[model samples]
Target: MLNSNMLRKLDMQDLMVFVAVYEQSSVTEVSEALCVSQSTVSYCLKKLRTSFENELFVNTRSGMLPTSKATAMYPHILSILKIINTCHSGIPAFDPTQKEITFNVCAPEYFELLILPKLVKRFIGSRFPVIINITKFHRDIPADELMEGRFDLVICFGPNFHRGVKGLRSQVLLEDELVCVVDKNFTLAEEAFSLETFVACQHVFPTPWTSDTNMIDGWLARQGYNRQIVARANSYVAALNMIAGTDFILTLPRRIQALTCDENTFSHRRPPAGLPNFTLDMMWSEKPSQDSANSWFREQIIKVCAEDGLL
Candidate 1:
C-alpha cells in the first residue's frame, strides 16, 4: 500500500514510463516512445519501483518481462492514464479539418478489399489530413487492448466480436452471405445447386480465415452433411489459381468473391439454402470521457459503407 508521501513522489511521467516499459518491455524502447532519455526513463522506473515496493519488471533473455506485481498493476495504471488523458483533452472540441490526427484501426483483409478503398477515397477527397493505421484482426478483440488505446476501432465478423467484453461498443456495418465460386467449365450435377452436388465437389478452403470446422462445416454438421475439402490456400488469389481449370469449389463471402474472382475464369453461384449470413461490425472502447473525434471517424466509416451499398 502506497502512502500519501509515496503517491506524491509518483508523477504522471512515472506512470507513463511504467506503462510503456510494461508494454514494450524495454527501457530504451520506452524512452524512445516517450521521447525521453534512457536515464530519465530509468529514473522514473526507479521512482515507480520505490513507490510501489516492487521490481515490476525483470530482464530476461527474451525481453524485459513484467513481474506478477506489474501485471496486476497494469490495468489500474492504464485506467489512470486514460482518465488523465480524457480530463486533459476531452473538453476541446475535435475538428478533423483543423489539425492532423491519427487513428489506428484493426480489421481483417475482407475490410481492406471492400471498405478501405472507399474510406480512403472519402478522406482524400475531404482533405482531412488524418492518418489511418490498419492492423490485422486476430481471433478475438481483447478488452484490455482497446482500453489501453492500442486500437481506436475494430472491424470484424459478427462471431469474432465478443459481446461480453465490457467498456466496448459495436454496431453492425453490413451483412453478407457466402457464395460458391468454381471454374467456368465446372457443371452442377443437379438442375439446381443442391446439397448433394455441393458436397460431391472437391473444395478449396481458404486457410486462417476458414477451415473445415468453420461456420460452413458447423452448419453442415447440424444437418448431418459434410463437404469434401481437398486443398487449403492462404489467400483468395492462390485459391483462385488452384481452382482454375480444376473442379474445386471455394466458398467465401459474396463481397469478397466479387472483388477477387474474374468473370472470364470463374463463376459464382448462390450457396446452398439455409446458409447463415454474417455481419461485419465496427467496435470501439467507450471511455469515461467521450471525444467527438471518435464519433466523427465512426460516421465516416458508416457513410462509406452506406454509399457502397454495403449497409
Candidate 2:
C-alpha cells in the first residue's frame, strides 16, 4: 500500500516519459515524440528512479528497457487511468435486446427438460439479441474456475461455496423428492415400495462424485435398508436407458419421474413414504448486472414449473 500524500505528490510526467522511452526503446525517439530535448528525458528518468526506490529502466545498446518493477507497474497504471476516464462517464450501457453478446451457461443436463425452455422464452420476450451457449456441468469443475470468470454462471445443488464469492444469491429453484422408477411393461406396483422391496431390487444410480456412493448408502442405513447400486452413471439418460424394461429401479429426482410419465406403464414409489426432499439451485457470480436478471430468470423458472404444479 502507498500513502495518499506520496501518491498525490509523485511526478506523473516521469512515468509518462519512462513509459514512452521504454516502449519506443529510444530516448531520442521519445524526445522527438514529446517535442522535448533528450536531456530532459534523462532527467525525468533519474527522478523516476528515486521515487520508485529502484532503477526504473536499464540502458541497452538498442535503447532503454524497463526493470521488473516498472514492468509490473505498467498494467496497473494503465488500468487506473482508463478507469478514471470511465468513472467520469459511468458504466458502458448494455441493452440485451439488441446487443450482440455470448452468454455461457453451465448446468446439469437434467435441467434441459424443465428450466431451459422457459429460459429461452424469457430471452425471446426480452428480445435479447444474443446466442446462449450451454455447456455440460460436472462436479469436478473447480469453484475457482467459475469465480475467476471462466463461466458466467453455474447451476448446481448448493450451500457449498468458496471465500470472496458470496456476491450472487441462491434460491431453492425446484424441490424434487427422490422416487424409484422402473421399466414399463413391468409388474412392480407403486404401492409395493416397502423397505423389503426397495432392498430387493437391483438399482441404477446417477452420481458424479465417488464420495456420493456413501451418502445414499448412509441415507438407506437410516431406514434400516441396504440396496445395491449395480450400475452407476453420470447422466440420467444413461441410467434411464439401463433401467428400461428391467427389474432394476432408479432413485432419482421426481422431475425425471415426469420425463417418463408418457410411458404410463412405469410406476414410482416414494422412499420410506417420508424421506426429505432434494432441492436443486441456480448459482451465479455476484455482479451489478446480475441483480435484475437473477430475479427475472428465477421468477420465470418458478412460473413455468408452477403451471405444472411441479415447483
Clashes of 1: 0
lDDT of 1 by residue, 62-171 (tens): 77899899999999999999989887986676687998999888887788788888888888998988998987766567567778888888887785624468788889
TM-score, candidate 2, is: 0.58
TM-scores for the candidates: 0.65, 0.58
- What's the C-alpha lDDT at position 94 in model 1? 67
Cα RMSD, each candidate: 16.3, 12.3
Q: Per-residue CA lDDT of candidate 2, range 1-59, in tens? A: 77444344456566678668768989889999988898999888777777677887888
lDDT of candidates 1 onward, in order: 0.83, 0.67
The TM-score obtained by model 1 is 0.65
